[model samples]
Structure formats: C-alpha cells, structure tokens
Target: MGIRSTLPLCAVVAGTAALQIPLLSPHQQAPLEAADKTKPLINSSALQDLISGDRLFTRAKKLFDIAKLGEDEYNHPTRVIGSAGHEGTLAYIYESILQLGDYYKLDNQSFPAVSGNVFESRLVIGNSVSKSAAPMGLTPPTQNKQPVHGDLVLVENEGCQIGDFPDSVSGNIAFIKRGTCPFGTKSEHAGQKGATAAIVYNYEKDAVQGTLGTPSPNHVATFGLSGKEAGPVLEKLEKKDKVDAIAYIDADVKQIITRNIIAQTSEGDPNNCVMLGAHSDSVAEGPGINDDGSGSISLLEVATQLTKFNVSNCVRFAWWAGEEEGLLGSDYYVATLPEEENIKIRLFMDYDMMASPNFAYQIYNATNAVNPNGSEELRDLYIDWYKDQGLNYTFIPFDGRSDYDGFIRGGIPGGGIATGAEGIKTKEEEKQFGGKAGEWYDHCYHQLCDDLSNVNMTAWIVNTKLIAHSVGTYARSFKGFPKRTSSVASSAYESEAKYHGSMLYI
Candidate 1:
C-alpha cells in the first residue's frame, strides 16, 4: 500500500539557535568536495551526547513553528506537497545539508507525484450512525450517485473471485473480509455481484482505513470495518436477522508533482553505503509532525552533527516527498536509479512515525518469511538496543506499506521503526507503554489534529536516541552487516557488545 492513511504520523540532540543551516534552492545541487581523509572517524561514544532529547526537541520546534503558520504564513501549518509550507520544509533540510558544506554531496531528485482525497465518508447502520466509517482511497464520488441500502450480504473468503458473491448479494450491501487481494479487487467483485455498497472487515485485526489501490467504476463505495466490530454483526446476520445499512462516499481528486531529497557523505567507502530515509511530506489533512517530521528532523539534526566527525562507510540521508501519497517519491527514486548504482546501497533504514501518544516500540520484523536478506540484521540492531534498556518492544513487518517499499522490492536489505498510528492499543500494550488501551496509538492519525500535542514525549525521545545509535554505528562500521565484496574492509565484526558503549542515556 502507498504511504497509508489511518495513516498517520523527530529531533536533535541542543539549542536549535546554534544551528547555522544555510539556505539552498530546491533544484540546487551542491558540488561534491574532497574529504579531509586525515580526521579519524568517531566511534559511538564520541557522538552519543550529540543525539540529545533536548537537542531533538529544539530542532523539532522548528518544524512545529513552520506548521503553526497559517496557509498564508511564510511557514504554512500543513506541509502538503507543493504547498508553501512544504517548500519551507524542503528549504530547512536543504539548508541543514548545505550547512555541512563539503561533508556531503547533495542531489535533489525531483519527480512528478500524485495525490487526492475522499472528501466525505458517512454511514448509517439501521437507526444508528457510525463514527468509525471511512471511505476507501480512490473511491468514486457518491454526490451524483445513488445511496446504498438493502440487506447486508456476507461474502466468503477474501471476496477476490466473482463466485464469492451469491444471488442474494445482488441489490444488497456486500460484507467482505479483507484478505488475498487489493481492496479495489474485492470492491469490484461486490459491484459485479450487483451489490450497491461494500464493507470489508479486517480479517485478523482491528479496523483500518484502506485504499482501493485505484479508481474503478466496478467498485461500490467501500468501507473498512474491524473484525472486533464485525463479529457480532456477522453473527446476527447468520441468525437471519434484518440488518439494514448505508454507505456514502464523495471525493476531491487532483494531482501534484514533488521531489525526494538525497544527500551522501563526501568521504567513506563508495562501494558500500548506509542509507537512512524519512518521508518529508505530510498527508492532506494535518501537519504530520509525528508521522514523519520526527524522523525527518532527527535525520537533519544527525546529519548536521555528523559533520563533526568522519565516517568509514558513506552515509546517505533522504527526505522523501509524496510518501503519504503511497510512497510515490521513494518508489520513483528507486525505479529510476541505475541498476549498478542500486547495487551500491548496502543497507536501507526507514523511519516514518517516530512519535505516537499511546506508542509501542515497533521494530520491523526482518527475520519473517517475507523479508529480503540482511533485513534481520537491521532489525536486530534496534531490538537489541531496546532490550539493553530493559524496555519492551514489538515487531512491525517490512511489508510494502512504507517508504522502504521500493527498496525492499528492488531486493535491497531494508527495515525501519514506527511508534504507532491508527491501530488500537491492546491492554498488554497499555501496560507496557501506558495509555488508554482502547484508544488509537495516535488518536489524531491522518486528521488535522496530528500536530505537536499528539506525540508521546518518552517514545519520541527514546526512538530518536535509537536512530542515532543505529546511524552512528553503521556510519563508523558496517560490523554486523556483510561488507560488499566491492569494498576494501577485510574483517567482519559484531556490534552486539559495542552497540551502546557511548550512549549517555542508557
């Protein structure tokens, strides 16, 4: 899925006033400079203090300041792609990179991106209205269309094939399970069965806002429901109960072209490079502070601080645009990179939502059956770091749901971290992270309220430190990861013992 909605949503280590980030044009490319090879590359301890919660907060305030500005304000509140505020965001990072001067070579890869919105989504089950109803992305406008009604019919097994629909489904609402195929495919099948509307329940988990993948007349206006919520309703229908429902969706469809920023160290092994990424653009509704700004700003702070030392392996930092538009920017960057250049990337780590009020420490599960090779090592780096702190952590699959989607598809080893988003927190998680068990991880997920207050300070601070821990360790030495045969590093070492050697917090 493209950067998801239900979708939702960094910083530094000091006084942000001390940052003398130089401004650079969006299209400007900084010339590469020779690295002063004489300076020794700093180890984890040499740079630990630099990754400060205070510092992270300082830089994070800059983004909030930008996002607080009104639409006409110089730094607009919403960093929607191509918006003035988004431009402000780009300028901030460009300047941050430019501040490093000769330390990194900068490349601004621009792409034509697309995005749209489901303007209104409403539902009424019997006499009660549902506040949880949401329109599937790419759902056609219901403004000029007929409202959905009649008996709700349950479709079997993921509803991928036309046979899943029965004669009774015609002229009714199709209740489908989310599995096997794209949401669009299921919805299309419902239409093929003559259903006026479609409701796809989350087969294994809680309710989620989903995309139909694309627009199609074959699709009936679709709504995603959670299994917990659907179980009783399904049982009632099975008992031959009369359950009437309605589904209405209207949308605003348009497009915008955007770019992804890529900056690389001037020094270090060119054959083997470590890549760090975060989405720079927010969703259509909110400022996306925790969604990605936490990750973006943290990387900026780290990049600026990184100039203070040298690195044995090249480190590349990317601020991806149009991520909320389905990871468009990152996908475009990967698709266009020459195959030879693509092979040069030794590892890719993505950081999307680094702050959620009711947060869970999520590390992408790289050892899972589906993950690409080397992904496990990337995940272990953070899991081990969290374990050392005696903190509880959980796994998030590196499936194609984020900016890392493209890299994983291209066979590059990739993994990432997320605080949490629209998913409801369980009681067990509540005991661990401490917040309302039934509430959304980020209550304001994909909404205009996903601003400064939506973040959990403790989660924000800890994750930022972990990011620095991973970046600094990899930049100094690949260690636990395989050194490319193309690189000169002769010996392979493990960082399991030295991973936290320099951190002051732990």
Candidate 2:
C-alpha cells in the first residue's frame, strides 16, 4: 500500500501567490471565529436566511431518503456483502451524487467504468473428519473442485520465510498460523512452498474470524479455521499424527464492474481544493450501514450543504466501490490521476464507518503507533475539531486499513474518523466509553444485524455534523490541512506564507 507518487512541491511553491487567512487565536471559539464581524452568530435574520436556505439537517434528510432507494418497504435494504444486490445500491449512490453535481453547478469528474474479476463461493465445510477449514477471500476456483488431503505441517509465525520451512513443502499441504503478516501473504507463501493446499489457523485464542486472501490462479487453494475448530487438529499434528481435511470452494474468476462516483463543488482556487470521501460498497454478507453507510450518508449531507456555498476552494466528494476488497477503487483512482492532478489535492478526509450502533469514536491512529501513514497536520486539525465539538475519541495510527490508504500513499495530506470496529474494548476503554469490558465496540460489525435500526442516531447525527463542519471549515480555512502544530492558533497569521495559490486544473 506504499504510495510511490511524489508531490510537485517545488513547482507548486514557485508558481502560486500566497493568500492570507484571518486568524483565530487560542481564546477565539471556532463558531465565533466562523462568523464575520458584521454577522451575528444567532441573529434571527441570519438563522431565518439559513433555515430557508440549504441547511445541513435538511440536506441530511434528503440524502437519507436517497440512501433508502434500495431499501425494503421497512426501509431496511438487504445490501448483501459483495453480491449483485450492491449494483442497485451503487446505482442509487451514483444518481444521488450526479444530482448533487447538477445542483451545485460543479464540473463533477466522472470515474471510468470499473473492470475487474471476482469469484463468489458458497462454501460449506462439513466436520466429517473434524478438521478445521474455512474459505479465504479472493481465492481462485479449484481446477477440479475435488478435495485434497495431506499431513498438516503447523508452520509458525505465518511468515513462510524460506528458512521457516526448509524441508520440502512439495505435494504436502501446509497448515499455517495466522499473524505477523496479512492472510494473503501467508497464502501466497504457502503456494510458493509447493503446498497443494493451505489451511490458516486463528492467531487469537478465541475465534479465528480473519479474512483469507485471494489465491493465485496457479497456486494451491487456501482456507482459514476458527481456534476451537482447529485446536484438535493442531493437537493431532503435535502428536505426529497425520491430519485429514476437506475443502469445497466454488471459486470462479470472472470480470466484475465497480466504480468511484465523484462530485466536486464548483471549481474555485484549484490549489486549495479539499476532498471528502467514503466507500459505498460493503463485504458480501451485510448491508454495510455502519461499515460505510454512516460515512457515505455524511458525505451526501456535506455535499448538499456545500451545494450553494460560494467557497474559496473547491470541495469534492467520492463514493468509492471495492474498498472492502483492498481499497481497489481509491487506489485505481489515485494511480490514474496525472502528476499535476495529484498535487492539486490539498487534503483528503475519509469518513469510513463514522458511526456504530455502539458509539466509541475511534480516531485513525494518527499517533503513528504502527506507521507514519497519517498527516500530522490533518490529524491535529481533526483532533482539534473533535475537541471543540466536545466529542470523545481515541487516536490510532493510519494502519493503511481503509480507502485513505490510496491518498496517504499519494502523499496528499489526509486523515479520517472511524467508530470502533472488531477491536475489543479494554477495561480502561470500557470505563471511559461505558461499554462492557469484554464486548467489542460494534457487536454486529460486518454482520447482517448492522442495519440502520441498530445505528445510534445521536452519534450518527453528531458525527455527520462534525464531518460537515470539517469539510466546510477546510473549504474556507487557510490553504489546506497544514502540518500539525502545538498551537493551531499560532498558525493563523502564517497562513499567508503557507497558501500556495491554486494549482493548474487537470
């Protein structure tokens, strides 16, 4: 996921004139700072103007209505994870953005039609022999669709280093423990070891719910197993007894279509454009309401709110497809953008899973605990925005785990906010967030139960408001998301020196 692209810093600095932004010192409130000296913050007249004008909540409702396009009579859409059903959802999202573009009079960019291949398998593993097995994602269909058996060699660390399994791994299938790397990496390594098949076990003590990577067309098949289901098999292997396993994967490789529906606010100063984005597609099992419906809805609301604003800089919104499939849409979008085009991107804010049924706001690890994947400036900006709104949160590293992966790789300063996912709530977090210690932030995460009814409307509304505020503020704030500063207040005057006039249009 590492971005190989570079920004044209020298060219940008050399060609653009600097613009000044009004300062809001440490004592100034963000809301107060937003009001011009002549305008009253709560003036009945201004309130009336805005109320009659485009309001965020009004726009939110309109967007909510659009999101209901594919829903059932009960307003509950069965947006199956990774199925053809998503096409209807995608069409709904596309038409919504197109309408926003028409409303805003913006030159919305159209993403090229997506062309890829996918194979969905309905796997049923019978415990006839009582050995653990589950199909992995992106796995290729079997040549004969016949079952294979072999002694399970418990490979440690899942690294699959040549030295890790020095003995001949040919013919015999390899059973690997998941960890130290991605499931895909482990599967690919097992294929290299001449493994006829691969069975990956859970790295955790409890359940092994990790995703398996797609296997190469020429490589052996791969499967994953829960810890409980795999323990006895491991026990037998430890006793030097041969383990028997059967894998039935209905894998097929066929071309698939995906897309990134993009809508931009009217072009203003090019160099200062801000991007707001969220993926629209979910895994092939559930209606990704929390996984991304939250973010997508927020973007729709923001797009509607900004529809009439005479912004200093342009704002763009994107509803990406294939994010759950390793961020394919975003990555393809970034990779295809020209160099000058890429540099014009001042900031990117991704809103993936912004709300959960159980709301414990999980900030992207901007602390860079795991990697330097976050923009320090963007992180601070987001954190400050949250603090001003009096929201509770935690900061983690970028993790290269979502659609932001593409933007971060491209060096376009970007950051995002996410409600918690599969991560367990610790005793400390439970005390702070008022959740059960043993429970996860979203129990129905990636499950069919993750529908709109389960969503915490209060948290959803607040998060949407915050996202709107951020996009609106950045649209009119100094140049773009700047590098993080200990005192964001101090950076106001320095804005004049920082703003690089608009970049050349693509």
Candidate 3:
C-alpha cells in the first residue's frame, strides 16, 4: 500500500547534521542472502535461534553512538523527533532494509509535526532564582520569553478537574502537584481558569521531565519542579504566606516534517498481514537506549532474520516517529489507511521499552473493556510463550500510552510486551524477577543516564526471542487467529483517546 497524505510541509525547526558514521562498517553486518523459495516455512524454534544478545547489544550501542553525534550545546545526546540523531536512525533502518534487495516493499510515510525543546528555564521566588526549573515539552513558552509575574496559587487536589482550580487562581500562577492526569490536562484547565502560568511538581524526589502531549491553544507556559524545590513553597502556601513568583521558559516550538518507515514482506498474502511496530525516536533527556532503542533494535534484528524464509502472511514492520511528543506517527498511519488496507491488517503488535534494568516479562493485558475483541488472543500468545519458557510474566494495562493506542481505537486487534518504566516494583515482582523491590524498573527512565548501561541484556534477548517466535508462528499460519469485525465499541475509543503519554497514569 502507498502512503498518500494531504498535510502541508512547514519550515524545519531542528537542524539535520549529516551522519558521519558509515552505513556498513566492519562491525555492522549486512543482511543475510535472500531466502531460497525452496526453503521450509519459518518456525518458532528456528526464528528464536537467530536472536543473539551480543548482536542486539551491538546494534543498540550503534544507535546510542548515533544519538551522541547529534548532541548540541542546548541538548543532550538524544534521538528526539526532527533532530539529526533521529534522522541518522531513520537512515540506518532504511539502508539496512535496502540491503535485503526487493524482499520487502518500503514506504516512507511523511507527515508534519510540532517539535519542541526547552533550552532555558527559570523560576524566581523573590531574590531566590531557581535555574533548576524544567519546562514541560510542547507547552508554549512565556510570551516572547518574558517572565510572568503573579501570585503563586496552590491548586487543590492535583488540579485534574476544573473545579480543583480555585477562582483565585485566575490572574495568577497555578502550583499543581503532579498525579492523576496528564500535564496537558492540568495546563489546559489552568488556562481555562485564566491562570497566566502553571508549575507542576513531581510527587517523588526525582526531577520532572514531562510533556503536554501536543500543542494546544488552551495551554499556557508550563514548567516542572522537583519535589524538593517545591516543598518549601508548598509549606509557605499552606501557612497562608503570601507567595509571588516569576516564571520563564525559553523554548523552540515549531512545525517540522517527519516520516515513518514501513516495510512489508513482498512474498506473503497481502490480504492477511501481521504487523509489528516500535517508536524509533527518543525523549530529549537522553539517548533512550532502554526506553525504546531496545525495542527498535529488536524489530530491526528480527526483520533482518525473517529474510531467510518465506511466509503465508505479509509481515509489516514500522519504525514510528514523534512518539516521544505523543503517539503521532502511529496515529497518523492508522488514521490515513484506507478501509480496505486497514482490514487487511489482521493483527498489530507493539514492542516498546523491552530492557528495563530491573526487568519483568510484562505482557499487555488486552482483556480490558477498552480493547477490541481479538486482542485477548494476542495476549494469550505471549502468556503461553512465557509459560513454555518457564518464565514468570506480569500483565500491564493495555492503556493508550504507546503506538498501539491508535490501532486498538481504530478497531484493530493489538497487543505487545514491555519490561517496565518509571513504575515502582513490588516485593512479589522482586522475588519473581530477581530485582530490588520498591525501586523503579528503569531507574534512569527519561533521564540523561539512560544509556547503554541501563539495559538488561538478559531480559532484552529473552524478549527479542519472544518477538521472533510470535512473528514466525503467525507468518506460517493464522488458523486460530480471529477475523476482523466491522464494529468497535465507541465508548472504548473515547476512554482510550484520553491518554497521551506513559506518565499520565502516574
């Protein structure tokens, strides 16, 4: 299927530095020779055998290195959308798949998106100027970078609902505690209440690096504060102490062009397609090796191996962009597909953040009321695979935080796997996964420290093997897989669409 878009291109906001790394170096191996048509159909064991942890780590390290090449004075090594690092990542995937000859049909689905980054932020409370202020991504900057001076009004009960923003918050700055809803929702509500700006403080001791999901007219200049930085301010407010502050965020928010890389096997039944995807872009804070680099590399490795054999169903792999800002690429892909093309996608599986340091084999729980009917079957496939391997697995909610959100809402059956991210581990999980309890599954999640060291090689390889098993099994046959139905639960779509990012649930 071809990519047809009516979206107009805009001026690029981020620089595209040329990738200095060679496409095929000594360490970067080429794709295996084309599959012999006479070869046997792909099997789970054979596919699983092709997954190598050493190879996975090598490729992941390559991606990290590419990210570092894009580093600038204003930003860290990151593959955030529209940056040079993400462009290099796109080139690597495209060139790698091209090496396999015409075995797969590649599509460059181009679209426009609003990319933003915070360069400088400040929160001044009297003479005490806190330069540690972190601006929420995609939120508009202070008008012309001028400081917004107003009384700091503490929002009641997390500021999730409109009523939580008191009338006094009008013509002032809303000091909100982070939790229960999206940062975008809080900012939107604050703007609705006529607040000039908003400050959201983390509930934990860690620094806050959050997103407003996407640009909105209702949003005001929003910033994040660490718990420690906001503690005294909160105490003073609680004691009815008069508090006035100046908030300023210098950010570059503008529209830019980005594309999604989609490749489908040329030899399989086009009418029956098995799809797999992962967001290829990282958050601005770091290289994002564990957050999604692991997932992206897993798909690349599996795609490379799949060329050795033929299949009964078309296998489509996608590397999505604009996922860090929100699930923009995937959402656009699903929305633009013709109804005929959409129905051909029998199943869509997502793999994201597969290598948390303190990992657990967590499969998406598709039994939730919001998910489509056939999603449960996909979940069972993963659960059975983990059981066969004698590995313990847990269920994470199939919420609309990732790329799968768009597919499920469009009535396609979707499911996938993840290790974990930012969520605290339980004692039972520690016993099962052999990791510390009461600690984050990924300690360096969305931080500059989320480099190669943050990955769990063992867990990553195991998860990659599972991906191979699922792809091979379904490619051979879909005898027990459910057929696509015409109708979807409307209420389900409404519920799922409300979620924008992973941090929203927290």
lDDT of 1 by residue, 1-506 (tens): 01111210001101111132222222122223224556556566556567777776777778877666436732336787767667778877877787667676666666776555666677777777765666776566553654667788888777889998888998888988876567778888888788888888765546557776545668777887767777777888778898899777776555666777777776655546679899888776778788788889778877877788777666789999987766778878888866656666777899888888889998877652354557778888888889998999988644456777677667677788898887789999888878889988888887787787777778877887787777788777665575332221111211111111001000
lDDT (tens digit, per residue) of candidate 2 on 330-390: 8778878766556656667888876666567666654333223235666776677678767
The best candidate by lDDT is 3
| lDDT for each residue of candidate 3 in 200-295, tens digit (9 for 90 to 100) | 987777767678876778899998888888888899999989899998887778899998988887655556778999988988778899879999
For each candidate, give its TM-score against the true structure: 0.78, 0.72, 0.83
Model 3's TM-score against the true structure: 0.83
Q: How accurate is candidate 3 locally (lDDT)?
A: 0.82
What is the C-alpha local distance difference test score of candidate 1?
0.70
Model 3 residue 71 CA deviation (Å) reads 1.8
| Steric collisions counted per model | 12, 13, 0
- The candidate, 1 or 3, that scores higher on TM-score is 3
- The CA lDDT of each predicted structure is 0.70, 0.56, 0.82
Using TM-score, give the best candidate's number: 3
Residue range with the least summed lDDT across 10 consecutive positions in model 1: 497-506
